[model samples]
Target: MDAIYDEIRVALHAVWRRRWLALAIAWAICLAGWLVVSQIPNQYLSSARVSVQLRNVLPGQDNLMSQADQQRDIDRVRQTLLSAVNLEKVVRGTSLANTVATDRDVADRVAMLQKAIKITAQADANIFELSATIAGGGASDAANARLAREVVQKLIDIFVEANLADTRDENSQSLRFLDEQIAARQRQLQEAEAKKAEFQTRYMGSLPGTGSIEDRAGAARAQLAQVNSDLAAAQSGLAAVNGQMAGTQPSLPGTAGAAMGPARARLATIQGQLAEARGRGWTDSHPDVIALKNQLQIAQAAARGEPMAGGDGGTPNPLYLSLRSMQADRAAQVAALTQRKAQLEADLARLGDTMGAQPGVAAELASIDRDYLVLKDQYDKLLASREQVSIRAQANNQTDAVKITVIDPPTSPRTPAAPNRPLLLFGVLIAGLGGGAAGAWGLSKLQTTYPTVQRLEKASGMPVLGGVGEVVADATHIARRRQLKLFAGGAGALMGAFVLLMGIEFLQRGLVA
Candidate 1:
């Protein structure tokens, strides 16, 4: 490294010593650089700015990109704006299209513009900007500006249009869902209304208000359980007739449904009384015994279905009336139970109609919520899509990022901003001086000089002599002076070449614009 540094230091000093050499090289390099700069065409730049946002449509987002998922969505939206298709359309249709720039050139310029565009992102933000620049002659400035404005405007239009399309879809979907619900509800309402109207016309000429037939039926059904319990107990008691007979005396002769036990029980009691009277050892002729025997015979006849002899006409016994009363009570109870069962059946029928027409309000609410959830998800997704396109568009082109608001436009240029003529002329003169100085310094660096005699003799491989002693001055020696004059003339001719080089640099810089 040190060696390299030392070499550079030496080169610098050498260049300094040969000032004209360095100056000549410097002028050469400057002129070349200038020539290149001049040849470069004067390009007209026109730019515009536009803003974007992705925000959830809650209330209003300043009427901008209002929607949730705005950042990622806006980024996606930018892609569409920066898309090759959109830029290509601008290239073909806009004022930039008519300029000297070709499709290939336009592509390259567009690519350069896309690279130059800037984009930034932050959480929960959807704002973005767009911009554009074009190269052309003086007249082309307006054309480029117009093209940029139109292209950016087109992008905004596309955004609004796309959003509207989505909104329309949202409306359409909601409308479809509502329509289906309304249609289904309409059918149900119609059926219910019809049923209610029919019931009113058929039964009372007016529909039952809330809790009419259904309420009554429900009450009746509740009672049905109790009624059934009572009926079951009655049936159980009736089933016990055989057991009652087995446990009872002859007063009941058969099972619950049979007869004859009451008569037999009275006959058996009368016979026992007769035996006790006889055991008293009374004669048959006695009035007490005869009286008892007469009673016994009458009771026996009655049990055997025979009529008893009496001074007065016979009449139906009071015990028979009691039996008839018991039968009547059982009949009345059975009839009452049968009537209640029939009424319950009629009430249940009425309840069925009411329940069938009833709407399921809770189920309807759940269905609506389900639909709304699905739509909300879809709305968020579409919003995200729009945002992404926007971000991509901004990043791809700086001008596309934000269309600038021009407060002042450019003024026309009279003389071209190039071709420093006087400067170039001064440069040519400087070059000539540099070349002459370099030639002198390089010559000075040599230790031996032909102008000196001692130096010349050593280089010629000859001995040094005190020539003063050997030869006298002559015309031949004087002729050698003529040869020296010719050499000086030849050296002067070489100086003309440096002057010629300087002229070339001047012309190149001055002529090109």
Candidate 2:
């Protein structure tokens, strides 16, 4: 460790003794670098900052775009800001495309502008800053401002149109729902009314010259009453005959009284003689038989306490009924007719009331029907309009899926940021340093290492040997080391500064700080 320290000390001393040589080479390289940097063209950089203000079109609603999504949108917006279209437009509008204006100088400036447009987003920022550099051209400010404003306005217009289209679709959908619902309700009302009308007609009876079922119900009831009266009279006649038969009593020969007296006997003999005379092959309906039948009818009537009808009327069979089938059938028919009549009467009364009410209802229904026609026409027209609008929308490429504009307007530039002279000079200076270093290294490779060997041999004193000669030590390496040492003592001190400066420059890295 002590020997290594001693060698370091010796090497430092050797560098000090050759101070003029080190100083001259370093000075030459530094001057050349400075001169080369001075020859570089002046570059101007322009920058414009823009803020993105997102608008929530849904009123009173918060924006759903999260911070991450918003960041993506910002990046996307940044990309759009630096799109080829905008660049092409900028280039097309500028004099940068005309390569023959000042020929080489103008072309050089234009190429610089083309290469230098930059866009950047700050961390969690809503703003975009666009920057450009122009070499020998004037400034980069005004052109960037124009592009930002133009793009922003175009995006805004696209968004506004999209919003309008969405609103229109919403309105159209609402109208369609209303149309369907109204039509369904109308059908239901119509069906209910038709049912009511059919029931009214089926239950009602018809009458000649009668307009309603109620008008015929009264006549039906009157017919049933007359039929009932006829039935009662016929039943009474039958009852009378039955009563006469029941009251009649025959006298007996021994039990009740003595035999008939001479006058009753003689009278019976005369009646028997008369009946025998009339029964000579004569029908009961013959004149002679009819006379006898009448005499018997008169006797029967006398016994029954009934007046005789002109000696005798045609005697009917006691077991038979006039229009017999018709009696039962008419009774059933009457009952059914009466029931039907009653139902019709009720229905008719209801219908009359309904009709009276219908005067108001019918007016309303008529009005509704009339308005329905008008509404139908309007609905048809609206539907047709909607269809046409749909077609137009398709033609215009404005469909259910609309293009959304995510980009916003650009902010105004606060300052003209053109002509960044100091930054350009610094960059040029760095380039010059790099070039000088590369050149010095290449030259060192081309030159021989005889000087380095002479110094090494004089110091070590163990040289005088043959060796491979393809590779060599660097002349510029010595100059670089000396230059680094001088810079290390750059704190108001000379190149051969104090030991402290040397320790600070080299030993600090190797041994101790």
Candidate 3:
């Protein structure tokens, strides 16, 4: 422990003896450090804070934006904010425009602008901070601060435009497209309705899905069967009536002159032919139908003992009245059957017309209905989407939807944000101390004369006998000591002047814009 203390004391004594040289080395290192630190540019930072609202709640709608979706939108906005187009716009709008004289300079300025701007969003929140940094390489502090503030303000403007105007324009375009589609669909629906109406008018009662023509024809045939049964029953009743009056009744005068059997047979044959003609889809105005009616009239006239084309105006015998009455009743029954058969034939003809058009009309109507329905469905979806987009656009325009608003405006920073002068100065001071200590140690090592006998023995590994003491100085030694003092003072003064001149130059450069 004593040896260690002795070594420390020797090192201290050596440093004190060479103190002037140590001071010169320390000051030189400090000046160099200061010059290097002073040459670096000062950076200024300007920041603005904003809060964005996701959505506005409205009646019958949940307009709240989801966290993931909002985050994605924010990411997209951030990317757009840093895009080359927007960066170029920012450059043109600020003092950066003055720095660009050529295409390459513009490109360089844009790159610098991108690196200087920054956007940050709070997690799970709608708050954001936009910041810009200006490194004034050779400019003044005031210019750096002003440039940073301007850049931040321009970024805020871009953010607002993206959230409002762009969204509204997109919605307007979508609404126009939906309107055109809806109009086309409406025309198609109208055309389908017109076609269905025309088909119904042409086919009358034979529309598919309403009762069919074959059904109506079957119904007419049923009515014809019932009429025929009634006619047969009436004939049987008339025959029975005639049988009861056969021997006791006297013949009528008209019946006594005419043979009723031949005339009755001929009328029945004419009636059967007319019924057959009517069943073949022939109208009452058809030539075949007209000829059948003429034949039936002639047959009926002959039955009454008149000329073939005219009815008789003669009287009848009283005794034959009973038989004639039965015959007349049978004739009336046949006439009623014939009328009913004609009515059934007319209905069948009408039903056949409806049946003929049913297949084609049903197919065409189905195709029309399908087309109309498909168009209607698409139109409805497009209309609904347009309404939703319109609502969102309106909300944005009104500042009720997701939008960025300036919460804290940008301000010119008063202090330099870069260089960290105090820290740098402290580091330089430490380095100065180290350099001074190193110089002293080097000087001590170069000296061959050992101040102590123990140090000489340790270095040379030889035995030390004794040490010699120096005599007092004479007048000549005193003069030499005074000259040495004057020389050291002059050198110190020159170094001090050099450091002062460098400091003034550094300060001047720092002040220029």
Candidate 4:
């Protein structure tokens, strides 16, 4: 402990001996540091907070923009707020414009502004914070502070304007594009309709049924089977009626009333059925009508050969007459069914011929129909989209979709936000003191002079029996005392200068405010 204390005393004494040189170095270092600190620019910051809210004018509609879409739009604006174009606007609208003389200057200003501006959005909220910084760049502190505020304000205006104008412009362009597409689709639909009509007139008109030829053929086959079944039933009924008629007598032996025989009854029934068939839109060339005519001729001959049952003979056998009437009705039914079968078979044959000859007809027709339907569907969708866009555009024009409220207006800084001038000045003073002290200590180490007898003995490796203190005259002592006062005055003046600089820095800040 004693040795350490001795070393410390030696170092202090060595520095004291060269105190003037230390003071000079401190003065030079402090002055240079203070000057550099004065040249450094102050940075001022201005910031604003804005809350955005989306309004839904049309409720319960799928066409309205979703929350995600609205949020995306807000994010897009926030991300682009610090873009070059917006920064240029900021520069032009603020005091920074005065510093720009040419396009290059403006570009340079914009580039600087890009670094100076910042936009941040809160999580899960539509609130955004915008801030701008302005550094000295040869401008006064007050001017830089004012420019920072102006920059934030200009950005706010741009943000609001961009949202409003972009919505309208985007909607307008979308509607115009949809309309053009709709028009084109409409023209295509008309052409498709015309082609379909022409095709149906030229080919489908002669066809038996609607739809493809295969479908017609299937329908014809089904009808033919049904007709064949009905014809078989009718023929069986006619045969039964004929057997019953053959078993019945034409006349009763003791009857005196006049009545027609079985053959005449059969002839009358056939004529009635023939008239009924004609009434059902059957032409004479129809198989049913031809068959009825042949039956009529056969009944007439039978009636002429049969014995009459009238007033002097006997009443016609009632059972025979009934059977003859039933036979006539069944024959008529058989003829009608046979005619239906022939017509169906003829239709099937024609369809088969068409299908075999033109295999691509069905494919071509399907393709045309498919194209027309697709076009129609696209036209409908485009129309729907157009309507939705129109509604959205109208809603935007009528009401505010995105409402921006300035929660915190741009603030004019009352003091610099950067440089920390007072702290820096204090640091320079400390550094200067340290550097001067170190220089003196290092200079003392290079010299051979020893301040104590022990240090002299250690360096020279010799025994020193004693040491003597220097004796001074009264005049010399007085001169040394005056010099000590002068050194004290110089060190005190350096501290006073540091204090004075600190005071000036605060005063300038006050003036700026």
Candidate 5:
């Protein structure tokens, strides 16, 4: 412990001997540090908080812009608030504009603003916080403060403008795109319609039925089958009537002419019914046709056995005359059905010939019809989309989709937010003092002088039996006292300068306020 104390005492004595040099070093370092600190510009910050509200005034408008979409738009605006263009606008709108003379200067300022501006949002709210800082622009503290506030204000204006303008622009673009698509679709539809008309006129004008060749051919085949069935029924009915007439007597055994007997009347009724059934397109295999044929046979048998009473001269047999009439009607029906069948067959034959002559006609017609339908569908969809866009645009014009309220306007800062000058000044003073002390200590280490006999003995590795203290005269003591006072005054002056700088810093901040 004694040795450590001795060493500390020796170091102190060595530093004291060069106290002037140490004080000079401290003064030099302090002055340089103070100067640099004074040159450092103060930074001011301005901030604002805004709340955004998304409203849906139109019915079913949520499908167009949902809450998530609104949130995304808000987030997008927040992220782009400090973009280069916006920053340039800030620079031009604020005092920063005075410093920029050329495009390059503006660009440089924009870059700086990019770093100085910040936008943040709440996690679960629609509130956004915008802040901007201005520093070291050769402008006064008050000017910088005002610039910062102006920057934030400009950002707010841009935020609101961007939301409204972007919505309108996007809606307009969507409408234009839909219109173009609708027009293109319309042109395609028109061309398809014209092509279809030309194709029908050139290739399908003579074809029966409407639609493609295959459909017409199918319809013809179906009609031919129906005609054949009806013709067979008619032929069967005609044969039955002819047989009935052949069996019926021309006159009654006692009466020449008389009203038809009950059986003959029934038989004639059945014959008429048979003819009517055949006229209705009923085939021979139909249940009604079968039933009628059975009734007709029964009637014929009854008529054959019935005795007739009439005038002596035999009148034409009523049953035979009725059979003749039925035969004529059935024959006419048969002829009509035959003609129809022939016409249908000719149509089928013509369709077959057309298809064989032009194998691609049906395919071309089908493609034309398909294209026309597709174009029509597309045109309708585009028109609907255009209408939807137009409606949304109108709604947006009527009411704002996004509403922004300034919860906190940009504040005017009285003091700098950065470069804490007082703290920095104090720090520099302390550093200067430390550096001076370190310099003296290091200089002492390089010297061979020792303030204590023990240190001298240790360094020389020689035994010192004795040591003598220096004797000072009265005058020398007086001189030493005066020198000590001077050194104290120098150190005190350095401390006083530091205090003065701190006072000035506070006073400047007050003036700015």
Candidate 6:
């Protein structure tokens, strides 16, 4: 323990003897570091703040963009603002152009600019903050402040343009696309209508919606009943004419009652049928009524036993002519009745078939109707969509629907934000202190003089009996020693300060260049 204490005491004395040297070294290093730090360009930070408001909506109305979606859009706009093209524009418009020409390529400058600018958004907040750090290009702090403010202003301009003008242009494009789609749907609707019209025209009578199958069947039965009645009257008249011709003599020409009996009966029946058709609203020029009238005239002529009118002809026996005419009339009546009966039968069969097919026809027609309705619905929905989109687009253009406001504008900074002079100087001072201490301790160890009796004993394995103090000098010698000490200290201090000052001047010149 004693030996340890003795060694520590001797080392302390050695450090005290070299204290001035240590102080000179420490000051030299501290000044040199301070010069280097002072020469580094200080950077100034400028910030611009913006707040976004989402769409204002009434009850039951949703915002055009949701909160998250709007945030994403804001993020996209932020990214686009920092895009290479925009950054390049900012560079060209700012003092960075000169800096870029002298310092680095365009790509490196762009990367540096991107690193220097920052865009940040707070969580669950509607505010965005944009910050840019500008290293004062020259030695003047005012130049850096002005440059930073200008660059941030440019970024704000880009952001505003992207939000407003770009959105408007996009809305215009959407409206145009919707218009095209609406037009196309309108054409398709027209085609569908045309097709439906053609279908209706081609199958008019049998079309499902024309009338019920039961109504059509009822009409067919009524017509069949009329035909049966007409056929029965025709057969009775033909029989009557045959009986009159066989049982009585033929009437003389121009006889008053010649057109009577069975022939009269036959004529009456034909007139009755014609009257019935007329009473049913058949026109005189209608085919069935016209034919019946012609038959009646021929029957009357045959009953009267008249000679060929307006013609030269031999006179024939009255009874023979009358019988032959009656026979011909009977044959015509039979043939007509038979034809009418066949037509009625055919009509009845058609009515039966129509009744049987009613359900299937209804189903097929309903399917057609459903298809037409589906297409019409689609056209209606498309028209509505086009209208809504157009309205939204117009509203967006006129109202500036998307809201972007600059809550805080960029401002010039009065102080340097970078190079932390005080902290850096303090750290350098500490390093210089440590270096000086290490150097002084090293130099003290290299000396050959044994300042301590214990160190001498340890080195040479010898015992020291006594220690001697230095001799006292005269007053003149003492004064000379003090003067020499002052001169050495002054010289060292001056040299160290000169070196530090020269280094600072060189650094300053390089920074300005």
lDDT (Cα, tens digit) per residue for candidate 2, span 150-170? 433433443344344444564
Residue pairs with backbone overlap in model 5: 255-310, 256-310, 256-311, 257-310, 257-311
Q: Extract clashing residue pairs from model 2.
A: none
Q: Candidate 2: lDDT of 456?
A: 57
* Candidate 4 lDDT over residue span 384-460, tens digit each: 88998898889889988889999999999988999999999999999998878888988999998989999889989
Give the Cα lDDT of each candidate.
0.49, 0.46, 0.71, 0.85, 0.84, 0.69
What's the CA error at residue 38 for candidate 4, in Å? 0.7
| Candidate 5 total steric clashes | 5
Q: Over 4 Å off in model 2, which ranges?
A: 1-5, 39-44, 56-85, 91-111, 121-126, 136-513
Question: Mind giving the per-residue lDDT tens digits that candidate 6 earns over 225-279?
Answer: 8878877877776776666557643333433323335665565567557644643
167-263: candidate 3 lDDT, tens digit per residue: 5665688778878877887887788768666766666434322333445567787887998888787777666556645653352334323444567
Off by over 4 Å in 6: 1-12, 16-28, 57-59, 64-71, 97-108, 136-140, 204-374, 447-449, 457-463, 472-513
Q: Estimate the Cα RMSD of every predicted model relative to the unseen true structure.
A: 20.3, 22.0, 15.8, 9.5, 6.0, 16.4
| Alpha-carbon deviation at 72 in model 3, angstroms | 4.7
Off by over 4 Å in 3: 16-24, 55-57, 65-74, 180-368, 446-448, 460-463, 472-513
What TM-score, to 2 decimals, does candidate 6 have? 0.60
> What is the TM-score (0 to 1) of candidate 3?
0.61
Query: How well does candidate 3 score on lDDT at residue 502?
Result: 50
lDDT of 5 by residue, 1-513 (tens): 987887778778877888888888999999999999999889999999999988775567544554466678778877887888878888888778789899999999999888998888877478888899889777778788888999999999999998888788888998888888887888888888999999999988878899999999998898899889989988998887777778878644444456567887687678767766664568999999999899888889998999875533544444555567777998899999999988999999999999999999989999888888888888888888788778778877888778899999999999999899999999989988888887888898888787777778988999989899899999999999999999999999999999999999999899889
Which of 2 and 4 is the better model by TM-score? Answer: 4
Against the true structure, whose lDDT is highest?
4
Q: Which stretches in model 1 have alpha-carbon errors above 4 Å?
A: 1-17, 38-66, 69-75, 99-124, 133-161, 169-223, 229-336, 340-513
Candidate 5 or 6, higher lDDT?
5
Report the candidate with higher lDDT, 3 versus 4.
Answer: 4
Total clashes in model 4, counting residue pairs 3 or more apart in sequence or in different chains: 2
Sort by lDDT, top down from the best? 4, 5, 3, 6, 1, 2
